[model samples]
Target: MRGGPPQAEQPDDGEGQAVLGTGPSSLYAHIVNKDDIDGLLIGRLCAQIVLPEPDPDAWQDQIRDVCAQLRDQYLKYPGVFRAALAMMPTNLDTLRVNEGLLAILLSGGIAPRTAAWAIDTLSLYVGAYALERSLLVQRQRREGDDWVLSRDDLVGRFEALPSDRFPQIRQHAGELTAGSGHDRFDFALGLIIGNLAHA
Candidate 1:
């Protein structure tokens, strides 16, 4: 689950295979290609995300719980989202998660088309968030700096913007970055769920 482009480690054949503790031939024999490996990893991660039983009264809340669990799993496997982002998860584990989400939306009276599309949007939204966060943490570690200080500096820069040119940025800099990742995630999740219900 290396971040960014999936490149061969040393520009040599079987380097990645070695990393997986297998010979080049054996690795290729089992896994068809990099995409296969991505599927396997995605399946494993999907397994960790538990989906609650469908509940008409609490469907929205149950969906939110699943999202939070997924976020936690992705964080635990830093960079996994980047690697598996493009993979189509047809595996049972991944499908089960999708099924659970769809069931919840259906139970909440969301239209079929909207619920289907919402699955993709919600999945991508959470995956992208996890990927960005993991990459930022990795970069901070490599640079040996405090993320808190960096975030503060960024906020300060925003506040220092010329009020005449960037009034909104200058005025709401604190509110712009006030919440934790979970808070922001929850806000967006609630919005999506609310829209589904209203639609």
Candidate 2:
């Protein structure tokens, strides 16, 4: 994906070039418009997602699972997450996903406004994570064998921070950098879900 200012309008023809050996004009023969492409791709993304049946008892766990699944789904499609940032769900698959999330929240006795806000918040979190990951992927592709920074280098810098000025950061230097992407994602997801449950 091409990275630029947020307002940039970039055309993505990489898929067409890879598959058809041509530009998007050839791709357009199949997809009526850009919205059609978004729907088709997102539909495939949501196809296998199994939303838990409505159960107030299991709502928290079920919603957690569903949110995790949605985040993973967004990351699965290499560059499609960016579309999610701009477009609302119009297709059946995405609508079903939205319906399932709202149902779980409402069943748990969450206020209607809270449930509505949570959907938007959760979606934004997932999209932001996906965009960050995609940007890193692009950077790796561009850098190839050239290394950006080693783990040792990162740790060393963190450790060398002035303890007096950056006391908290210095104290938790290792903790700051420790954890895989999945670990951090799960941690944040749990916090969001837990806060929602309590709220």
Candidate 3:
């Protein structure tokens, strides 16, 4: 939970403070505790990801573990999501995460397509971290939350509640769960891919 060399703990203050411009030495004066995940595990996991031959079958599994690791790291006080941000200060452009790294990840039995997803889509920048957080948040909610109502169904459920003690909760509950995953992803992907046709 402690004892590592301190990392510069700053958020996305890319305003006057550009990572390409200023050193992290004087961004601000705050420090985040390094209750981050084991660097070794993260390295190994990254090694396991980015494989050229990632198996689609095992992709979900690898995704699960990676998301779990992210969640575990998130369990720390403050925010563990910033872990990836902290790791980005090095020579990221020349970072050589070759297929060999991907191959090693596939050796762990990850699916080829999933491995490619990890390598191509997920590993490009902090994009993979977003995917990881998405999975982690969904799993955390799925495990602990019992809310079966989507937004469309929430209005009815809220009105069905016993008392007005939950006024604020009752007020904005429907806006929470609006669309299905399939609809959301399809619509977004459609816009992206469809826009390409126009461009």
Candidate 1 residue lDDT tens string, 1-199: 3334333432124333433456645654676566666665667778888788889999889988998888888787776666556877787888989999999989888889999998888899889989878877777777555553555787899999988999998888888878875788899999988788666
Show where candidate 3 strays beyond 4 Å. Answer: 1-41, 53-81, 89-149, 153-178, 181-199
Q: By summed lDDT, which 10 consecutive residues of candidate 3 come out lowest?
A: 32-41
For lDDT, the strongest prediction is 1
Better-scoring candidate (lDDT), 1 or 2: 1
Q: lDDT scores for all predictions?
A: 0.76, 0.73, 0.42
Misplaced by over 4 Å in model 1 are 1-26, 144-151
* Runs in model 2 lying further than 4 Å from the true structure: 1-27, 30-32, 144-150
RMSD of 3: 12.8
The true-structure Cα RMSD of candidate 2 reads 5.0
Q: What is the C-alpha RMSD of each candidate to the true structure, in Å?
A: 4.8, 5.0, 12.8
**TM-score winner:** 1
> Model 1 residue 158 lDDT?
91
lDDT of 2 by residue, 1-199 (tens): 2232222222343542342244555556665566666565666677668998989998888887887887787766667767677777887988898999999999998888888888888888888987887777777788464555555677778788998888887777788878876788778777787788566
What shift in Å separates residue 127 of candidate 3 from its native position after superposition?
5.2
